[model samples]
Target: MVRLMRALREERRWIAAAGLLFLISAVLGYFNARSLDETLRAAGVWERLERAVSVIRADPTFLKAFTLIYWNNVKAVLTMMGLGIFLGVFPLMALVSNGTMLGVVLAKTAQKTGANPLWLLMTTILPHGILELPAAIVGAAYGMRLGMMAAWGVWGLVTGGHREVVRHWRRLLERIPIVVVGILLFLLAAAAVESILITIVAK
Candidate 1:
């Protein structure tokens, strides 16, 4: 954990870049959410999200709900990282899609509350979102890094044959700890806040 934190701290620039990417994605999503159905369709996770929502509504215990939410987020964060080897395309899309979902939800919430969108954002998302968004950005950043490694690995294979590719693979493996540990810790905090603190406040 200490090593993971240190490594993430060292990559402050990358994290900031990732944060900027996240905000850009959110802005894009907000605009796209003007056509909510289209944006949701593009996201392609509405069915799974529906099921998750059902579970959240049905589950009586906070632990069970938290577990469900945590694992789903874990899968998402991992997908962002794993698919990043596709040269970061998937991670960027995921960010945009998620941001779109947030926009749609916040829009609906604002409508229901008869409040401004920014007020709805502040009341509903700002708390856990602070932790969750950075966690996601870290996942995307690492995925983008992995994609770069893969690109370099391919370049190495073409130019230097196997040796350079092997070196790139080794570097990629060494960096996995920072991505995994950082995402896990941040998401855990986000989940706890969303399920416990936010829920309590909402009531």
Candidate 2:
């Protein structure tokens, strides 16, 4: 945990930039969701979301929900981290897409249930989002770092600096495990908090 915090402090700029982009995308998605009649053609999205919410609300076993949600979050974080090596493409897309989905869900739910979107978000996402969102951005940032490192290596090889590039690559590989471990720990904490909060709130 100390190592993770140190790494986050070191890469604060990258994570902050990703978080800003996510917030912007979320705002756009919120506006897009507001005009559901014109913007969304598929009614299935609303139906599926409603069904999922209903299932969560009606389920008796909080442990089951907690486990499922925790696993899902773990998978998402791992996938994002693994995919970040592809020139950071997947990480960027994942962050933006996730933010957009969040906005859409919050807005749609509020509109349907006659609740305030801000209140719904506060009750549901804020608890876990405090950790999860930053952890996600940190994971993506590390992934982007890896992607950038690879790109630099490719460029170096093309420019006849192969030995130097190889050295740098070795260093990056050594550091990656630390970042991965930190992200996993963060996600675990986030999932636990989210599951507990959601279960309590739902009940």
Candidate 3:
């Protein structure tokens, strides 16, 4: 636990930076949803309805991969930005993006329906959405932490100002796989929830 805390502290800056980016994305989503209020009201929201439905109907594999890639890319960006925190940002980004996606969906649903919209979500996404969203978000937060560690580790190597740099760098390298596997595990949890839970709820 102490080691983990140390790791987190060492990579705190990277995490903070990545968090800002993730929060920005969420804010963008909310703003877009609110802007579409007029458009949705004008179009009777039926048009947007099809597009929204298409999100599920379209090539699920492609959608999943695209989404996954989006998260991974952000993770990579943050990790690189981290300097030597030795964190893997891919997993972190995945989690954050998924959470954002779910938030967008939930927000839109509530806006259009003027209520909780929990029934629809329960039928269409629950069970799985619940599992998947949490897993992804947790994975993302952890991944972001790892990426920052990698960044700091690298920074330490170059500057060699701090005695703890080398030690932390090695820790970051060792932690990468742990973080990667952690993300994958969450992905699996999400998948199971989506597959079985979504279908059952729909029925």
Candidate 4:
């Protein structure tokens, strides 16, 4: 835990960058909610999301929902981290996409239910998002870091500084276990709250 914190501290800039991008994109999404909704629907993404939600809602015991939610989150975070190696494009895109999705969901929900946006956020998202969002940010942050390293590596190779590139790669690889562990812990807690507590509260 201590090591993870230290590693995260060391990469704070990347985290901040990822968070800022997400916030900005979310604002954009909220403002353009209608158009975005249309676009997502056209792409079939909205329908898929609805289907997934319906499946989860139909599960009586909540265990299926918990497993689904947890694994989905785990896969998403891991993919973001793993694909960040390609100049961090995947992580950056994921942040913007996810942030926009959140905004769109909030806007649409408010419009459909006539509920205050703040109330919706508190009741629906905050219960789990407090931890889930941070976990996602951490994953993206590390991904951005990896992307930076990859960029540096290209420069290093061009400049014949292979040794330095290798050293940095080694260090970054060493931190992966710590990062995964921290992310998993957060996701587990978040999933439990989302599947059980939030589900009950909503009912």
Candidate 5:
């Protein structure tokens, strides 16, 4: 936990940016849920069923985005968006947006359930989020390194010195082990949460 906090502190800008994105997303989700609930209440059974079918049809897009979005959300929750450690501006923006999306989902779920937010969060979110989020962080962390190298490479191209680029890339290569470890832990936890805990709780 201390290390995690340290990691967050070290990557504060990225994490904060992600968190901001989460807040925006949460607000949107809350309204969307409310709108859906209202529709659910007003619709006849057939209409509601039709809406459900529409949702099913949309699931493909959801899944495609969900793969990336899920991990991004997970990263925000864990407060592990540390791309700024390597790259600066772009990474920070990405982190912030990622974090905001996470916050939005959480906030929306809480609002959707009111008093039962924890239960919903634990069951619905804790499942895939556990693995997906961490994997995102690992990816983000690596991206930070790549971004830094790319940025430096560009700078070197305009000005003239490959030293920084080589140095940053070398350090990034060393971080591969850390990313692997982080992703592995995240995936393992997510699998258990999704496959076991959520089912048991839902039952």
Candidate 6:
């Protein structure tokens, strides 16, 4: 736990950047909900999402829903972390896309139900999102750190600073397990809350 906290503290800047990107994209999605919806529909993503929700809703025990939510999140976070080596592009893209999707959902729900968007968010997303969002941000942050390291490593190789690059890479490798475990724990808790609370609230 202490190591996890330290690791997170060390990567705070990247996390903050990821969070800000998500916030900005979410605002954009909210304001441009109609266009975003159209785009998603065109890409078939909207249909797929609807089908996924329907499947979850059909599950009475919520076990299927929980498994789906948790595994999906785990896969996405792991993908972001793994692909972050390429200048952190994947994590950045994930932040923007996920944030936009969330905002669009909120906007659409508010429009459809004529409910206050904030109220809908509070009831639906906030409970689990409070934990899930932070976990995602942390994962993205670590990915960004890896991307930065990769960039620096390239520079180091070019400048004959092999020892420094190797040392940093080793340290990052050591911290990754701690970081990943922490993110997984957060995801697990979030999934449990979402599966129970959000499922009930939705129904």
Instruction: Report the error of model 3 at residue 50, Å.
Output: 8.1
**Per-residue alpha-carbon lDDT of candidate 3 for residues 96-138, written as tens digits (9 for 90 to 100):** 5543555566678777778765675676656544544433443
Candidate 6's C-alpha lDDT? 0.89
Residue 61, candidate 5: C-alpha displacement in angstroms = 25
Task: Tell me the TM-score of model 4.
Answer: 0.93
Q: What's the ranking of the predictions by TM-score, best on top?
A: 4, 6, 1, 2, 3, 5
Worst 10 residues of 1 by lDDT: 194-203
State TM-scores per candidate: 0.83, 0.80, 0.51, 0.93, 0.50, 0.93
lDDT string for model 1 (1-203, tens) is 77787767756776777777667766666665668756576767677788877777776356766787789889998988899999878987787677767877776666678898887788768876888887888888788777877888788778877786787577658768766887888899888777786345435
- Per-residue lDDT value at 29 in model 2: 82
TM-score of 5: 0.50
- What's the residue-level lDDT of 65 in candidate 3? 35
> What's the lDDT for all of these models?
0.76, 0.75, 0.53, 0.89, 0.53, 0.89
Candidate 3 regions exceeding 4 Å error are: 1-32, 36-100, 117-126, 201-203
Residue 126 lDDT, candidate 1, scale 0-100: 88
lDDT over C-alpha atoms for residue 59 of model 3: 47
**lDDT-superior candidate, 1 or 4:** 4
Model 6, residue pairs in steric clash = none
Which sections of candidate 4 miss by over 4 Å?
198-203
Q: Which residue runs of candidate 1 sit more than 4 Å off their true CA positions?
A: 41-44, 161-169, 197-203
Give the higher-lDDT candidate: 2 or 4.
4
